[model samples]
Target: MSTYLIGDIHGCYDELQAILEQVNFDSFMDTLWLTGDLVARGPRSLEVLRLIRKLGDSVRIVLGNHDLHLLAVYAGIVRNQLKDSTTLLLEAPDADDLMNWLRCQPVLQVDNQNKMVMAHAGITPQWNIDTALQCAREVEAVLRSDSYPILLNTMYEDMPNHHHWSEELSGLARLRFSTNVFTRMRYCFPNGQLDMICKDMPNKAPEPLRPWFTLPSLIAENYSIIFGHWASILGNATPEGIYGLDTGCCWGGELTLLCWEDKKFIRIPYAGIKHW
Candidate 1:
């Protein structure tokens, strides 16, 4: 049995399908681990969601920032930003089903047997695998509950410089930070301060802000984390147990797939630019 970990799909269903076809995916013998951002910015968001849903237990997705935003928008908690491009999903006949499936995804996924942890972004230097899992479950519970709206209402914005996982924090906001840390996080200050506004690669980051992958911590040194969402830098590359799957499929870059067991990579060239 082979386990393939795919980077951020971002609704590039055609590229996803082509990559899967090239890999000769077999539902009976293969498992797919997706590093979130399963929808948005590209065409065919609905198709991507449907294909994953159809695959069922054969696939697992760690929630991405885009996925969380979709849930928030669908729940009437947040609106899209200016660059939003998920009209295909909104118009899909199964939009409700797509949203439901997305909300069910976890923020952190780990295969202890393989010692591989997957998230949309990188785990904080402060969090070990266990702490990360616990926090992810906490937020997952709220996202899955009927009070999801209340949680969503409080979900946006950056968190306190130092987060301690408090019960007083809104569940949606909790989800937001967790999502940010695991999926959207790129750089943080040396003392473990997150700088959310910086989107450049670590080399160009202002002094004191180090890439999460380079943090000198037990989690960084101990576990193998497979993540996407930082397409501008580590595109379709695997280095030192860190895999970046988001080859900027939405931005005319390739869509990459990595086979977990062997670390083999496959890529499908971007077809064209998508306006919405």
Candidate 2:
């Protein structure tokens, strides 16, 4: 009954299977938590989505930026990138079912019993746990609604890149901010506004731009925050209670999994096959 948390899969189905087999994961018993980006960038995104969907109730997932992009592409809100490997998934027989399931997936998941919270990127420092959860629900509601394409469309519209969270923000602006924080955020300004551009490692980041987790926040003091999206970190050492699990498996790095109860990490190296 171990709970396992794996980083971004990014369509690396073979490595995902290898790591799961190495842990002897039993879908009927063991619980698996995924950091999302379940598709794109690898050889077998269709297979990856199928496998995770087949895992059923044994798995928990938070939607990543890539996942949202897949939804937008599926809805014809945006075109699929030439380099994306999700075309097979889009053409699959169950594409509709898979996309519906994915859109219904929340951007944030909290395990009260385990005292942990997970998002694809990470929570903003300006948001307390309650506010974060509320904002997540707001976006999740939109994604799960019939008007979901509206959100998928509006989220990509050219707006101020540095729109800080505010109690007064409403409508599409509010949903977009919440979505970006949950899926695209990496760094924050000293005043707590999101820095969406920089993806460098913390030390190399320009001055005053700190990793979101490094900022002082109420959630960091209370529960372990698990996230992916910044593959540059490559699952390196982070501050206590902060877990950056994306090991860049799609970029020829390793796929990493953490056994939550014991904090043991299991890593499976990429096979170095170029899928894109």
Model 2 Cα lDDT, one tens digit per residue, 202-268 = 8899998988887888674769999999898886757888899999999988899999999999999
Best by TM-score: 2
User: What would the TM-scores of all predictions be?
Assistant: 0.90, 0.96
**Model 2: clashing residue pairs?**
none
lDDT of 1 by residue, 1-276 (tens): 999988888888899999999989998889999989888888778888889999989998898888888888888777765465676677678888778767877888888788888888878777778878888888788778787777566555565642433445554555666656765687777766667878876667788777877776556355688888898884533448676677787788888888877878888887857563
What RMSD does each model have against the real structure?
Answer: 2.6, 1.4
C-alpha local distance difference test of each model: 0.77, 0.89
* Candidate 2 Cα misplacement greater than 4 A, ranges: none
Q: Roughly what TM-score does model 1 have, to 2 decimal places?
A: 0.90
